[model samples]
Target: MISRGNRGNALEALVAGLRGTPTDRADWQAVIALANRTLLTPDLFSSLARAGQIHQLPEDVREYLRFVHDCNRER
Candidate 1:
C-alpha cells in the first residue's frame, strides 16, 4: 500500500519523469495516478502552481479546468 507521506515524493517523481522523459509509458501512467490523487486534495491547485506542474497537466484536464475557471469568473 502506498503511504500518504510518500504521495508528495511520488508526485514529484512522476512530475520529474514526465518533464524529463515523457516518452516513457510508465511516466505517463504515473502522471495519471498523480492526477487522480490530486483530485482529492484541496492543495492541488497551489501545489501544482508551486511545482510548475500546471503546464505538465494532461492537456484535456488542464483545458477543462481552465474553461471552468473562466466560466466561473465571468459569472
Candidate 2:
C-alpha cells in the first residue's frame, strides 16, 4: 500500500540518506521498499556511490544495496 503522499516522504528520505544523513532502520526500510517497488534500487545505489557517500551507510545496508544493484545489472 504505497500511498502517493508516503512515496514523497520516502523519496525525500532516500535523497537524505544518499547525502549521508543518518536515518533509522525504519526510514531505510521505507525508502528501500519504495525504491524496490519503483525499480529505482540501482539508481539509488548509483547515486550514493557517485556522491561518495556509500561508505557512510552501515555495512549491512551497503551490502544490501550493492546486492540489489548487482542483481539488476545481471537482469
Give the TM-scores of the predictions, in the order they appear.
0.35, 0.72
What candidate 1 gets wrong by more than 4 Å, as runs, is 1-51
- lDDT for residue 40 in candidate 1, whole number 0-100: 23
Candidate 1 lDDT by residue in tens digits, 1-75: 455655655676555543443322333344445755665222333445455666765676556545544554576
Error of 2 at 49 (Å): 0.4
What TM-score does prediction 2 earn?
0.72
RMSD of 2: 3.1
Question: What are the root-mean-square deviations of the candidates from the true structure over C-alphas?
Answer: 6.8, 3.1
lDDT of 2 by residue, 1-75 (tens): 668877778888786765656355336667889878878778878888887878877788789999999998998
Quantify how close model 1 is to the true structure by its C-alpha RMSD in Å: 6.8
Name the lDDT value of residue 3 in candidate 1: 58
